[model samples]
Target: MKTLPALGDDARVRLSRQGGFAAIHALSRPREIEFAQCDISQRTRICSVLEGCLTLDSTVSGRGDQRFYQIEVNYRSGGQEDRMVLKVPEDQAPGELVHLWDTGQLL
Candidate 1:
């Protein structure tokens, strides 16, 4: 596994997509996205969508074939660490964020 770059007073968003009729596991590999490295608009969209979820640790129910996405966020400020995790149904995930998962480029 490759290590994500260190963040100093910055944030990171890691997205994991899994769960499908043809899938084997409940969760697929997670891709780490450096928040500061993303395009301004992408970062803004992600931040806005997740703004209500910065402190939430929950999951949304969905059908068997529906994909599940696990979003892991880590933030560091003032030498303190803040973390949040959210597993939501495919329809509930933001398109911009999902695009980042499908492709490393945040467009």
Candidate 2:
């Protein structure tokens, strides 16, 4: 995996899940952009949690009966594009990050 740059407020995080159903929730800091599943207020919180590559230290495995999560982070800085993406099984993902797929809540 590539190292993530020091992210700025413009950073964006998308949480996607799959198992019996599919869903996506995005936290985007750029105020003007509009996306249905986006909850702007959570942008700062999620971004802070994502710093230092949280939850990316090791590879995660999944089972068919449980939900799996894909976390994608994106941002542009200094004329370059930088991003980090990871997939984690429900059993291994952080509780707060997984909550969004089920209850649309974050801690």
Candidate 3:
């Protein structure tokens, strides 16, 4: 399975030309990642969020009594680059996790 980002008033869409080469033959850059599994039964669902050039990749996985939701985000701005990885238990709400990330706190 695949997940999608929420689109609201802050969302805008743009298109970029990435096919072919300017002069000689060149390969087009890939814009999306392809998952190895196509069938829903063999796939795990996740959500993606794009804020400016920043991307938030989130997913949930576990076994037995342990389960967790993980989020990975990385971006560059103002000549500085940053990355964050967060994992929240399945029993917990994602709001608090977002708050922690917003505050630059890690757990």
Candidate 4:
């Protein structure tokens, strides 16, 4: 199974207080953004991006039908999760997924 990657030092990570909640944004490249919203009443960070692309590489990982692509990502919010995962063939381009994931605009 494909797994997600960790957040890199390149991420412009930030946090903001929204009403009774806390929202975090981690942005990078060509205007992509990863966001999370959490309730402030909790003792820990609850909001999370879960999984989203941080970078894209053109190199192919395998050959023919057994092949798959990679997208590096900051998998979880609160600076806890990050990794690389296989790219999923979506209706939109891979960059679009990254944009949606970053901006919290995914449908």
* Highest TM-score model number: 1
Candidate 3 lDDT tens digits, 33-76: 12332233212221222231122223443344444434443334
- Enumerate residue pairs that collide in model 1: none
Candidate 1 per-residue C-alpha lDDT over 31-99 given as tens digits, one digit per residue, 9 for 90 to 100: 877766776776666666566433332354345687877777798856888776676677666676567
Off by over 4 Å in 2: 1-4, 19-44, 51-53, 56-66
Give the per-residue lDDT of model 4 (tens digit) for 1-107: 33333333433332211111222232122232333332232112111332332232223433343222223344556656544433432222354344444453433
Q: Candidate 1: lDDT of 97?
A: 59
* Model 4 regions more than 4 Å off: 3-31, 36-70, 75-82, 90-104
lDDT score of model 4?
0.33
Counting clashing residue pairs in each candidate, in order, gives 0, 0, 0, 8
Worst 10 residues of 3 by lDDT: 12-21
Off by over 4 Å in 3: 1-64, 95-107
Error of 3 at 80 (Å): 3.9
Ranking by lDDT: 1, 2, 4, 3
Q: Evaluated with lDDT, which candidate comes out highest?
A: 1
> What are the per-residue Cα lDDT tens digits for candidate 2 across 49-77?
45533544345433445556666777777
TM-score of 2: 0.55
By summed lDDT, which 10 consecutive residues of candidate 2 come out lowest? 27-36
Error of 2 at 56 (Å): 4.9
Give the clashing residue pairs of candidate 3, or none. Answer: none
